[model samples]
Target: MKQKRFGIDIDGTVTCPTSLIPFINKDFSLNITLDDIKKYDLSEALDIPAERCQDWFNEREPDIYWSSPLAEGAKDVLLKWKEQFQLFFISARRSHLLDLTQKWFETKDILYDRIELIGSHDKIKAAKQHKVDIFFEDKHDNAVSIHEELRIPVLLFNTPYNQDPVPSGVIRVDNWAQAEQWVKAWIDSESFIQQ
Candidate 1:
């Protein structure tokens, strides 16, 4: 049997984007807490026209993705999963971060088949093009959209701002350990039945 294909997100899923928040807060310097950073509506804080904010985000793309640190166990879990599935990173971290993100993966020695860095808020189209079977993501809106449209099973990685209730059929997991076990059990059960 062929191995399943997984579409994984970068920020807040495989890695924590906390570093970017500090940058954003320092640039704004509103004495914001981490929670405030997480809960902040970028549109409101930036207080700019939509197109201008888009431009600003594009300009600051590097500061966001490259500064993040990988989540705990993300490297190990991904390495283990590489043995059972084809891993593809489907991130909304802009095209500029392609080289940086790839270098980050190389440093971690993560063996993924592909890495896609789409612009922010355009993951669903990218995932559809990739034919991703399952996805692990941390963004609530993205998860809901992907799950609703593609009906793909998404393992939601818990995050402060993403604590909104997940729709039915979407699995919510606290950490990568639980995610690894869930995938392993499913694969093992399939193997057993085939035997």
Candidate 2:
């Protein structure tokens, strides 16, 4: 049987949702938490001009990604799944960040079968090209669109910024632990069906 592939987003999914909070708070000199991020736009959350926020992010993107922390329980679950599934990480990060991203993964002691830096939020093309059985993401629109377009299950890691309602195929999970539970059950069902 062919190995099932898992398409996962890198940042804000495997990495803690609050990973960028420190940078934002320090650079902008504001006291904010993850709860302050009610939307995906950092500018909107910080009440700053979008252009200024974008400039700041562009300048500090590398440092931000390099210093990101892994989400709790993500390492264990991902490592365990590494034995059973193809871990295909699909990220919105630019292609130039490949080296940095790989180094970051190594620094975190995480393993991946493949990593695709698509530089855009629209991941439908890459996901379809890779033929992933399921997807994991923290972006609300990305999760909903991927599931709806691909007709596959998508686990949306719940966060303050992505509180939007998801479609039926988009399963909202609180953390990596909950995500693993859902994936395990799904895998078992798939095995039974294949058998």
Candidate 3:
């Protein structure tokens, strides 16, 4: 089988979706559970002004990223797929944090083919530039846009915030285990189609 280039997102996809909840609750002094986060932008759910939210995020971004716990099964499955797939991490994080990102990966002992931090959630261009055949994402709009713009399948990790309608190409995965199974199925189906 040919090696496939895969696009993966960080933050809520690689890291547990609720990883930042504790920080938010303590910092804002508001008791909100992960279930209360219905929007990817916390400002919308928290009823905080966008500017204030952005300012707070800017100040606490590094700490949030550094302290996030990995999503269940993310490391093991990614490790197993490392040799078979070109694993590219494409995040909305600022590129300046490349050192931190790399350090975290090193600390986790994970391997990757490439890591791109574009400082924006709009990743269709980056995905196209990388020529990725498949994408793993957690943002609803990002997943939809990437799937529509690139015409490639996207495995959107299911989270409370991203429970939106998706087209046929956008597959929802509850965890990395389901992600692995979906990728295997997709590859098998694609192979059959090509033949």
The number of the candidate with the highest TM-score is 2
lDDT of candidate 2 over 94-165, digit per residue (tens) = 999999999999999899999999999999999999999999999999999999999999999988989988
Off by over 4 Å in 2: none
Q: Candidate 3: which stretches are off by over 4 Å?
A: none
User: How much does each candidate deviate from the true structure in C-alpha RMSD?
Assistant: 2.7, 0.8, 1.1
Cα deviation in Å at residue 182, candidate 3? 0.6
- Ten residues in sequence with the least summed lDDT for candidate 3: 182-191
C-alpha TM-score for every candidate: 0.84, 0.98, 0.97
lDDT of each: 0.78, 0.94, 0.92
Please report the TM-score between candidate 3 and the true structure: 0.97
Q: Which stretches of model 1 miss by more than 4 angstroms?
A: 37-40, 45-56, 192-195
Clashing pairs in 3: none
Residue-pair clashes per candidate: 0, 0, 0
